[model samples]
Target: MIEIFTDGASSGNPGPGGYGAILKAGSHYKELSGGFRKTTNNRMELLAVIKALEAIKKPNQTITIYSDSKYIIDAIEKKWVYGWIKKGFKDKKNKDLWLQLMEYFKLHQIRLVWVKGHAGHPENERCDELAVAAAKQPALPADLFFEAEAAREKLF
Candidate 1:
């Protein structure tokens, strides 16, 4: 089984943002993070999960994800995302990331467990540190997050 802990950080609601992910499999572990020029916390949260799933090399692996975002965990755990997908994601935000997530999710057996942020979970704490550091880094590039935001705007 693979375990992933993720966190997202933003300097401002629509300001510089980043996500951090820690993947553990047996005795091996990997840390991943990246910053965006402008984005939101929710987008960063979803992106963290996306990046972690993308990093997984093995197919059909049993994976457990720990996240602090109710926006993410509730959507999946409560089957709201499935309803959104069924309706073609109309009037919804982050459809692109959601679609991407569904694709990756289908490739692996995955479960999401929500954890309280800043509650001192070791991996979660490290993820927060990585996210904050990445957001503070200089010269970070723009992410597809803004593109998704633009697409949502066009729908309105």
Candidate 2:
């Protein structure tokens, strides 16, 4: 079984944001993170899980993901994202991320466990630190989908 831990941080809600994830299976361990110049906390939250899933080299693995985001946890575990997909994701946030995540669902058996943030869980705290550090880095890339959606929203 693989254990994955994840967290996300934003300096200003929709401002500089980043995600962090750690994957461990037996003796193998790896960390992943990236930052966006402009994005929401929710986007980072979702992306952390996606990035971690993408990191796994083999398909059909058993994985348990620990996350601080109820936005990601409840959506999948409660089947709300499935309903959103049926509606073609109208009026929903992070549709692009949700779509990307579902492909991994077909590839692996994933279980989501939500951990309370800032409660001193060692792995969770480290992920939070990594997320915060990544968000603070200079010249972060744009979260293109988020930017495009925000632009389109302002035109209406």
Candidate 3:
């Protein structure tokens, strides 16, 4: 089975944000991260899982994901996402990422483990460092969905 540890960070609720993921399988490992000029921590958290799942090359892999975001773990574990899907994710915040994640979900058997943040778990800590560092980088790309939503909010 492949194991993935993920973390996301944002400078503000809707500020520079990033996600980090570490994918491990036996002796092999890969790290992934990216920054957005404006995003929410929840989006970053979901994106980290999406990025890790996308990195997998094989089909129908058995995957275990470790994340600190209850926003994700609970949504799936409690089957809330299924209801959201039926309702077309109406009034949802991270619909873009959630849709992407659901697509990836069809390709793998995924299990999510929730870990406490800032609890000194090595892999989780490393992911946090990577995420925070990426968020601090210059010239980060704008998060399109976030910008569009903000613009709509301003208009309405």
Candidate 4:
């Protein structure tokens, strides 16, 4: 089984944000991260998971994801995202990321495990460090998630 740990950080709400992900399968390991000039912590959190899953080269692999975001854990495990999908994600935030996540989720046997942030967990701590550092990096390109959100709002 593959093990994945992820974390997200934001300098401020609607400010610079980034996500960190560490994926381990057998003896192989990979780390992924990216920064956004303007975004939210929650968006980064979900993006971390989505990016990690997208990194997996093989579909149908059993994977366990450790995340500190209750927003992500509860949304999927508690079936809230499913309900939102059924409702066409109307009146919901982060609909773009949610829909993207659900697409990747359907391709793999995935499990979400909630872990306490800032805890002593080694991988989790490292993820947090990566996330914070990415958020502090020099100005990078805009986040597609946020850009998509802006475009969607213009339609209504």
lDDT tens digits, residues 20-131, model 4? Answer: 9999999999999988988889999998999999999888999999999999999998999999999998888898889999998889988889999998999999898888
Q: Give candidate 1 misplaced runs (Cα > 4 Å).
A: 145-148, 151-156
**Cα lDDT of all candidates, in order?**
0.90, 0.94, 0.94, 0.91
List, residue by residue over 107-149, the lDDT tens digit for candidate 3: 9999999999999999999999999999999999999988998
RMSD of each: 1.9, 0.6, 0.7, 1.9
Q: Total backbone clashes of model 1?
A: 0
Q: Point out where model 3 deviates above 4 Å.
A: none
Candidate 1 Cα deviation (angstroms), residue 33:
0.4
Best by TM-score: 2
Regions of model 2 farther than 4 Å from truth:
none
lDDT of 4 at 13: 86
Q: For model 1, how does the per-residue alpha-carbon lDDT over 1-156 read when each residue is reduced to its tens digit?
A: 999999999999878998999999999999999988888788889989999999997799999999999999999999999999999988887788899989988899998999999998999999999998999899888877575677667898
TM-score of candidate 3 against the unseen true structure: 0.98
Clashing pairs in 2: none
Q: What would the TM-score be for candidate 2 when compared with the true structure?
A: 0.98
Clashing pairs in 1: none
How do the residues 1-156 of candidate 2 rate in per-residue lDDT, one tens digit apiece? 999999999989899999999999999999999999999999999899999999998999999999989998999989999999999998999999999999999999999999999999999999999899999999999999999999999999
What value of lDDT does candidate 1 attain over all alpha carbons? 0.90
Q: After best superposition, candidate 1 residue 53: deviation in angstroms?
A: 1.0
Model 3: weakest 10-residue lDDT segment is 88-97
Write down the TM-score of every candidate: 0.92, 0.98, 0.98, 0.93
